[model samples]
Each structure stands twice: as C-alpha cells, then as structure tokens.
Target: MVVFGKELYKIKSDRYKKARGGWSRIIKLHCVECGEYLFDYQKDGAGILKRLYFDRIFKELPKKPLKCKCGQLLGIPIIYKKEERPAIRLFSGVVKK
Candidate 1:
C-alpha cells in the first residue's frame, strides 16, 4: 500500500506476457475528510510503473478538494489496462443524493 496525502492506494500485478504485456491491479482511495484521491497501478507485480504514474498525476492535480455537488467528497476507484493505459474504467457508480 502507498500513502499519498490523505488517501491510500495499492496495486498488484496478476499475470505477465512474453512481449511485455501484463495485467495490473489498481486500487484508489479518496478521503472524504480531506477531499483528496489517491491513485495506484502495478505491472507484473512490480510497483515502479505505478509509482511513477501516480506521482505525475498528483503533481498535475490542482491543490483543491474534489467534492460532489452536495458538498460530499468524491472518491473514485478505477481499473486500467495497458491497452487502455490512460483511461480509467469506473467499477462503481456514485451515490445518488
């Protein structure tokens, strides 16, 4: 597990391919109190790639809380594949007010 600011993130690789292909597990946590989100990813059971990517995204994010319309903080947990590297697929939906 990796701690980033107020959130916790972790990644675990499941399988690997010969030609540099693999499945990675991503876990992200959002802190309602701090209104911050932590993103994580891993490849071939290694965290190097995930760490670098997380660091880059964190630096690019604004120093502001990401809150819902009702003032509740929003946290998104996403899964991404190398084939879809930059795009995150949401496994859950937001709660309805």
Candidate 2:
C-alpha cells in the first residue's frame, strides 16, 4: 500500500452478525488527514466483486485527501499507526449491578 504513497486507514466500522437479504454492511471511512467524513457506502458484503471493489478503493486511496465542497483541504490524518486506530472498550474493571 505504501507504494501508492498514501496514508493507511484501518476500518472503523463494526461487523454485522446477520444480514437479512445478504451480507450488508455500512462502511464508515474517514479522511486520514482531517478526520472528516469521507463517505459511507452501503454494500452487500457477499458479492465476489465487492471484496475487490473495496480493496481497490482503500489500497489505492483516492489521492489520499478529500476536499470540502468549497475546495479546501479537509486535512484528514494521512498516516495512522496501529495504536491510532479507534477501538471500543467495554469495561475497565468489575461491573456493578
């Protein structure tokens, strides 16, 4: 991916256990520079081409910078380390009921 000269993005979306019609997922991708909302695509995860589609988009990284409607740089983070990716921490210690 580095060959593309673009920042890497770890997927921030959650995994769905069951999809009614098919394996549907709401993909949430943010700009690496400004952390702005890049685009949210609703897709069928079961399609064979779908995997290739996503890989082509993320791996290549669309010039790596999304622009606002005004044409200004959104400044999303270009590079993200493993630690920089966000995670959901359920509990830190014992839970009280």
Candidate 3:
C-alpha cells in the first residue's frame, strides 16, 4: 500500500524521537490478502508526560471483515511494537514486553 503525506509525517516524527534516544513505538497491521504485516508508529508520548496524544488515525479505521487469500472472512492480529535498544539489538529483541 502507498503511504500518503499525513502517514509520512507521522513516520518522520516517530523516527526523530528514536534518533534522540527515545523509545520506538510501532503499530502493526496485517494485509488480508497475503497475510503480510504493515508496521507503523504509535504517536503517544514517550513514558509518562502527564498528558498524552491518543488521537491515532488507526482508531478511526472501520473494522470490516478481512478477506483471506481464499476469499473467506478471517480475523487477523494487530501487533504493537514499542521499545528502545542499541542499533544492532533494535530489531533483534521484542519491542513490547
């Protein structure tokens, strides 16, 4: 799927925080056709900052029945990955624990 302007902005902001030694917050979605995973970032605050930004675009997404490769409605899993680590260990370990 092609990402639009607003989606790109969200990704850039998430990357900037990671560059500044902040935790990376990932939001994962799945493709109904191929069972492929699409990973995005959660836009909430880093740790407890008193207030939080909880208005995520995904929250507005409508949950229509997902179609499988065989054209059947099947439920899929949405994973969230959020954590911090060294460069090599970033993708190595669990993002959420």
Backbone collision count in every prediction? Answer: 0, 9, 0
Off by over 4 Å in 3: 1-24, 36-60, 68-97
The model with the greater TM-score, 2 or 3, is: 2
For all predicted structures, in order, the TM-scores are: 0.21, 0.26, 0.23
TM-score of 3: 0.23
Ranking by lDDT: 1, 3, 2
What is candidate 3's lDDT per residue for 51-95, written digit by digit as tens?
Answer: 112233233323333333455443322322343321111221122
TM-score for candidate 2, residues paired by index: 0.26
42: Cα error in model 2, Å: 0.8
Choose the strongest candidate by TM-score. 2
Off by over 4 Å in 2: 1-21, 46-97
Clash pairs of candidate 3? none
Show the lowest summed lDDT stretch of 10 residues, model 2. 88-97
Give me the displacement of residue 21 in model 3, in angstroms.
15
- Superposing all C-alpha atoms, what RMSD in Å does each candidate have to the true structure? 11.9, 14.6, 11.5
Instruction: State in Å the error of residue 43, model 1.
Output: 5.3
